[model samples]
Target chain A: MAFLQPLIFAIVTLTVFFLAFKKYRVIYANINLGKDEKIAGDSGTRFKNMMLLAFGQKKMFRNLTPAILHGFIYVAFLFTQIELIEIFIDGFTGIHRFFWYVLPLGGFYTALISFIEILSVLAFVGTIAFLARRNLLKVPRFHMDEMTGWPKLDGNLILFFELILLVGIFSMNTADMALADGKYGFAISGMLYPLIDGLGDTTLHIIERFGWWIHILMVFGFILYLPASKHLHIMLAFPNAYYGPLDGGANKGEIANMPRITEEIKLMMDPSAPMPEEDPNAEPERFGAKDVTDLSWKSLLDAYSCTECGRCSSACPANQTGKLLSPRKIMMDTRDRLEEKGAGLREHGADHDDGKSLFDYISTEELRACTTCNACVEECPVSINPVNIIMELRRYMILEESNSTEEWNLMFNNVETNGAVWKMPASDRTSWINELEAEAEAEDA
Target chain B: MSELMASGQEKEVEVLFWVGCAGSFDDRARRITKAFVKILHHCGVSFAILGQEEVCTGDPARRSGNEFLFQMQAITNIETLNAYGVKRIVTTCPHCFNTIKNEYPALGGTYEVIHHTTFLQGLINDGRLKLKDGGEFKGKKITYHDSCYLGRANGIYEAPRQLLELLDAELVEMKRCKSRGLCCGAGGAQMFKEEEEGKLRVNQERTKDIVESKASFVAAACPFCMTMMTDGIKEVEKQDEVQVMDLAEMVAKAQDLI
Candidate 1:
């Protein structure tokens, strides 16, 4: 029956990994539903962006107070992985603190555990502060209109999970120290041992076993919950940053040229040009994005990578001026619509339609309210371009549905007729030159 | 005065003044165009306009999601520009500057494009242009409203500011300036259309920053921003105190040329 312990640990770990893998596969497939777009820039630029934005959290420094608090949790979460290796090995070999013997140096394990102990303490404080910011302090960005129910709960849930995980870690370390009687000499737990030392050996052993199990089980639960939570940003931010627009791309206010439209326009403008062959069976290409399938895969990745921080919304001109357009809500709605369509795809075949499009999730008013000022794009910490998604959706509304304001329609008509935004003709484009010459003559006179 | 090239003149010049639709046709923006042209003449830098040959760069059309119309204009303009072997161009409007500099390369129209402020900065840097001592703009309190296309889009926050720095006026900054600058409610072709449902107008919100800055003269680089900021000042009932002046107009005033 001694094998039962390792067997249970093995079964639990395998089940968690399988479940996480299954969810991840579905997410990957859902993201692939979007149209393929070649991300501009070489590997060097992408790698540099990933390292600076995702790993170094460079953008997080824009707001100093939250960045420092977040840094405590982020840095601790990274160092916690070192201690996790020991936990997994101990669980498999039925040897508590297995690295104690496996590691080459004598004091290395003690030093590493002490370091983890110090980090977990900071993580515990950071998690509590985050919870207070959400519930007590009520940070405006965290409690916006879109963040009412699940988003609010999701934010708190992760913080609570971190707190519990830290509690479990401290429980295991302190009890193990009490049992050791100054042998291992972990810094934080050594100080804590006196409080729990009066509890006899048997009780201390049970507490250690209980805490060890709880910590590992909580990690497994976090893994399964990640794909369903906005916490997925923890994994997706890297790839999203890597595939973000380069310097010469959208950042320079360059709207992507529609190649299909370009080809058609070229053909229409010149009769003498050679005509290209068209396939009869091929579906007509869409001018812009109408749904998740019409958007670029990079846009879908942006949806998954959104942390729901609402920095974009906070900085948006439209949102700040009390308009309906919230860039954060755009990413959230895209994710929601994608998930709905993804579920439909799983049930029905490739041609699955729930009779709902992105318009059903995002209203026309919200789409139209965007100024495309790139404030939202610049404010996003993870390089998620809400403007890209907004532009695609707006393109769909205008080109596919011909849904537009009368003013926009008039502007469009003017441009088509006169080769300018206003109703002025091309012949009058250089009229200012004459006005200048007349003004110069008047000045001389 | 430097010689201004006429369309199909067959004469070469140092640069081409791509007078945008607003600069050419719009009454208010024409003053900016004239101011820049005067500065060009003051410095004796030879330049030309395409006259009837130049059309809109289709900045508004593309931003409004009318790609077909935008491309039509883009193609037509590119043909005219490429045919004339136009290599260097300068524009008073940031919209035209951004479109020709960033978006035209893909459609086979590439040229050395410079915004009017950047062009002015170069003139000042080269010592080709100089200002009179303490002219109309001297010692005035001025705040520059950043154009979205010129600032964040093109990473040109400093060029306009650099031009402003040469003025004897005290240059004060608004709360939201540079990369974090608020929109004057005129970007994305919004100048031609009414704003979508909002509690307060976008430019009104931006005006609050200008008002907070307490500057008398609002310096603007883009024609659209100038219009929006002027309207915002009117909305806030500060038109009497706060005046919106373009960089070229300010520089022209300082040089006693306008």
Candidate 2:
């Protein structure tokens, strides 16, 4: 019990430290947040979306086999917390019988533990399948691109984590088999008791302690390491899924109602109004996002929350058709750039070099290659809208930097002149509808 | 079509069929539209033609990121419909139906929009329209391309296929058909705009799949798709082997054969 108390304290303390570090580095940061304020407001629809996406795992289930395997593992991991707690208690008190008498349905407990044992094995098997599907199978459709930076290492790390979890679970079960004499709480562990009987008591105790420590340390390490890795989905997925737009709705068409162009001119000339360039300390006019600080807090959270699962890239029509744009890469670029900037600020004590911005780092060629398709958002398990981010960047490029594709400029001109993308005269706009009875009213009275 | 009028009020008018931009503009589509109108009339269903007065439904505008223009066109079309007292609209173009039904409501345009396939199916079920036994021309396997607006946006997959079945054509489906149908590089105004920097064209990819299916004929609900797929077929040098026809055209051709 005394030795187990130190383990408990270490786990709790580590959890607090992990949470604090995440809050400080990600949640408190203003630069990475999206510019949109409406995202913060609570809506019933958003809550429903969250429930469907997180608990229901609606998006994940799009791929049937993987979804089922992941579902089992997820549910088992959740319920197995009870077994972990019991292990910790038993290890500390040296009384394996503590929970044995409390459970009214002793048989049910045994059944549940046995079920968990089966589920754990299934989870291990699923992990291997996932690894092969991602790495060994080399499914061209699932292959990561150059922009998917460090995917091989990330994939291996996840496999390692899952392997460690499986090893610890089996070792714990073996230890439990050694400690119990006659009846056991779990069927699988009970079945293994005969095998443990041959091993001496001292050796059994050492193995039990070793398994306990290994399991605890691994769990703690996972918790602390989550915020830094692609596995950050463990913490951010629920919120990201919940906050996603409802019903996979299209983007709102209306622009923000700013001061009218007509009013701006009037105000500039009025004697009562402050003249242009008169006040030296006047706030700089911000047409679009100029830097990371220009983004909203939710956008920042989005950056940190990205799971890097490559689902977005896999589903992207543009990527599938051999376009330069990969939605996964877009998210990665933002996150990596932000982290780089954050590190720079930390190292240089706010005297950071302004030679390059995130835009500078992410090539314009890559940005222009995007078709503005919503496939990424549709397929994303966490519901991150990469299309919106790309559009925002486009807005910045056009309004602030005066950088835009010639096609966009021409299209915009055509739209401005003819009120149509085809650049036909406004008079001919109703030409196609001219023959229908509706045409009479469409024409001038 | 006669039964359709019988099911309605004593007035003989059954439906107001809307011939959209591509239907009127393209020669092949125009023939299909004329055939569809003639078939409907033959069924004893009285219908009114809007003629040249029927302008664009603003699908191209809305999809091309010109929302303002879409709204303007929507308002004009709605006012036109109100003036004509149009309660129901049957359209050959799925894009027109989607815009008039789904998008128009936001712009205060309200009218019951029905795709031609649905209207034709309803007429057939009600015994107004009869399928003429064509005895299968060319004995060619036919695959139906589900338009995005019709299939995914509005859930009108079965009706078109059902119409095809009535024609006695063997409906061969692609591996990714119906709800997961590949876009023919036409929707969202990709038809008018230059193709983005993708290695392969969307239409080419979709057409390649169609070619691989080895179906001699590809039928679609949207004229935009018909145009794109035909172009794709031509590009792949399968122009002589494969033909692109609208569902209405296929139905009309089958009716003529009978």
Candidate No. with top TM-score: 1
Q: Which candidate is the best by DockQ?
A: 1
Predicted complex 1: CAPRI docking category? medium
Q: Candidate 1: which pairs clash?
A: none
TM-score of candidate 1 chain A against the true chain A = 0.97
Every candidate's DockQ is 0.67, 0.13
TM-score (C-alpha, index-matched) for candidate 2: 0.77
The estimated TM-scores of all candidates read 0.97, 0.77
Residues B45-64 of candidate 2 have per-residue lDDT tens digits of 67664553555666654444
- What 10-residue stretch in candidate 1 chain A is worst by lDDT? A245-254
- Worst lDDT 10-window in candidate 1 chain B: B1-10
Expressed as tens digits, the lDDT of each residue in B1-258 for candidate 1 is 225545534556888889888888888998998898888888988888887677788887777777877888899989998888889999999899889988888999999999889999999888898766777877788898888888878888898887777787789999899888999988887888888887999988998999999999999999989888888899879999999999999999888888
